[model samples]
Target: MKIVVVSDTHIPKRAQRLPSRLLHELRSADQIIHAGDWQSLEVYEQLKQYAPVNGVFGNTDNEDIIRVFPDKKIVNVNGFKIGIIHGHGKKMTTVKRAFTAFNQPIDCIVFGHSHIPYLKYKNKTLMFNPGSATDKRKAPFYSFGILTMSDELHAQHIFFKSK
Candidate 1:
């Protein structure tokens, strides 16, 4: 499966729309995952044009978004259990919160909040943060994530200097 992962769009607050590069990437995605901070339903509607999307809602999301999605969720794809969260709160770091959000076994965790691209292994689970496609914050590049599944799972960040 070709999964495109993104988060913290912040919509018109951060940018008027999804980055053009991100839209281009979405064209080839088999599935899309948004970690959170969508801020508007328009983002979801936009992503649905490419592929089925599953995600969590962040602290910045409005009632409409929260009503449609949870604060955390487990998405099953090709038998791989992936945990998704916004990774926001008052305790610990964003990664730490995501690492412990789920009480069950998960092959990977996709989360965002700090707008920093991160990919690493914690314990036995893969921790992935696609950063901010619209708001890179202090990161050098705007970024997203891609997950390829076959005999094994592979994940990589798609970074670009321009939007």
Candidate 2:
């Protein structure tokens, strides 16, 4: 399966729409995952046009988004267990917090909040943050991610200049 991962789109608050490059990836994806900070249900609706969207609600999301999605979720793809969270709160780093959000072992953890792209392994779990598709924050370029899963899991970050 091919999964396109994105986060912190911020929609009309950060950009009027998703970057063309990101949209292209979405169009070809088998599934889509948004970590959080979508800012509007419209963003989810737009993404749904491309593929099935699995997401969490971030701190900036409204009640409507919260009602539709939860703060954390776990999904199984091909034989891998993936945990998804927005990763926003006080104290601990987002990565550390994501590691503890789930009770059981997971093959990968997908999270977003700081708008900085991250992909790393801790203990045996893969931690992935696709950064901000629209709001790159301090990052030099806008980014998103792609995950290919079959017998093994592979992931890569795709970056491009913000328009």
Each candidate: RMSD: 0.7, 0.7
Give TM per candidate.
0.98, 0.98
Question: Residue 85, candidate 1: how far off, in angstroms?
Answer: 0.3
- Model 2 spans with C-alpha error above 4 angstroms: none
lDDT of 1 by residue, 85-148 (tens): 9999988999999998999999999999999999999998999999888888788899999998
Give me candidate 1's TM-score against the actual structure. 0.98
* Model 2 per-residue lDDT tens digits across residues 82-160: 9999999998999999888999999999999989899999889999999887988788999999999989999899999
Worst 10 residues of 2 by lDDT: 130-139
Q: Which stretches of candidate 1 lie over 4 Å from their true place?
A: none
